[model samples]
Target: MKNQLEITLQNRKNLHAILEQTPNEDLLKIPQGFRNNIWWNIAHVVVTQQILVYKLSGLQMRVPEALVDKFKKGTVPDGTATDAEMKMVADFLLSTITWTKEDYEAGLFKNFNEYTTSAKVTLRNVQDAADFNLFHEGIHLGSIFAIRKML
Candidate 1:
């Protein structure tokens, strides 16, 4: 789980780099044939990790309820992200992972509500969610990369 968190942290650093470097307009652009934008993908991953690992573990999410509502599964980009909101997402990309690692090390997660993901994978514990989150982030990273090409 420590290794998984390390990889998640490194991946978030890469995501943060992209977020910092991309023009805000580019981040919000939804390319043809895509339902969402780069910014949405980045934010979605952050929201997802919280839900999968924390919310389902019966703990409150690190991020706000509004953020979770906006980016959680089945929600499309709302077509707007204020500068403050963007920065919040960018900041959480690292901070949330750091928190997750710390919380895990502290043994805060003792039980996880079983969840069957859209991909049909069942997460029975925090460890499963931790592992599944990596795959979820990889998928979004690929989407971000492809969107960058189109931009």
Candidate 2:
């Protein structure tokens, strides 16, 4: 689990670098054939980790409810994000993962409500959610890479 946490933290750092380097306009642009922008994908990953690892574990999410509402599954990008909002998301990209590691180390996640993802994968525990989160983040990372190419 520690190894998984380390990989998640590193993945977030890489994602945060992309968010930091991208111009605000570019981050908000939704390319043709895509439903969301680079910023949305990045923020979605952050929102999702909280949902998968915290919410599903019968704990409150680390991020605000509004943020979770905005970026959670099935939500669109709304085509707007202020500079401060982007910075907040960027900050959470690392901080959330750090907190998750600490929380997991402390055994805060002793229960998880079983969930079957839209991808048809079932997560029966926090460990499962943590592992699944890696795959989820990878998909969005690929999306970011493809979107970067289009931009």
Candidate 3:
């Protein structure tokens, strides 16, 4: 599991580089045929991790309610993210994972509300949610790469 987290963290750093160097205009632009922009995808990665790990674990989430509403599954780009918003997203991209690792190691995740994900996998424990989160992030990372190409 630690290996998985390390691999995912490394992938996020690479994704962060791509996003950091991308022009703001390109990050916000939804090229033709794309359903969302790079900013939304990045934010979604952060938001989804919170929901899967924190919310499902019956713990208070680190991200705000509005952010979760905006980026939860089944939602699309609401609008272009400003520079400040993008920076915030960039921060959470790494911070949240670090916090989760700390929280897991500290045994903060003692309960899970028991939710089955859209992929039909039931997460009965916090570790399951954490494992599932890696798969979820990988999908969104691919989306980010595809969206970046369109910009």
Candidate 4:
């Protein structure tokens, strides 16, 4: 899944530039029918990776616990994300994936605690989680795109 992972990450980076170009007002605007804003969706994708991969494997995640709690599944955007926060998200977007790749190469993920996603897909190991993360990110990207249209 290495090549596929790279492609997904690249796709995210490309999409992220479009998101970054969004006006802060638009990025943070949660349309009446939507559960989250563009910023929340983007940050959720990043936070989800940490949860599905690192947290499930019992390893320390790169992102802070507060961030994970704020953007993880079932959470909604409580308020607007500032420009500074969005910039941080943009900077970390690719960096987190690159670090995950490097860490995977270093064999840091020795054990994976199996997990079942809300979609009912069960992931039993690190590679499984990694592959699942691509799908998860894709879903959010689709959401982001839709939210962009609403904005």
RMSD of each: 0.6, 0.7, 1.5, 1.2
Query: How do the residues 74-129 of candidate 3 rate in per-residue lDDT, one tens digit apiece?
Result: 89886677677778778887888788888888888888899998999998887788
Candidates' TM-scores?
0.99, 0.98, 0.91, 0.94
Question: In model 1, where is the ten-residue run with the lowest total lDDT?
Answer: 78-87
Q: Give the TM-score of candidate 2.
A: 0.98
In order, candidate lDDTs are 0.97, 0.94, 0.82, 0.84
Candidate 2, residue 22: how far the Cα is off, in Å: 0.6
Candidate closest to the true structure, highest TM-score: 1
Residue 82, candidate 2: alpha-carbon lDDT: 87
Ranking by lDDT: 1, 2, 4, 3
Name model 3 segments beyond 4 Å from true.
Answer: none
Residue 54 in candidate 4 has what lDDT? 93
Task: Report clash pairs, candidate 3.
Answer: none
Q: Could you give the candidate ranking by TM-score, starting with the highest? A: 1, 2, 4, 3
The local lDDT score (0 to 100) that residue 51 gets in candidate 4 is 93
TM-score for candidate 3, please give it.
0.91
Worst 10 residues of 2 by lDDT: 82-91
Off by over 4 Å in 1: none
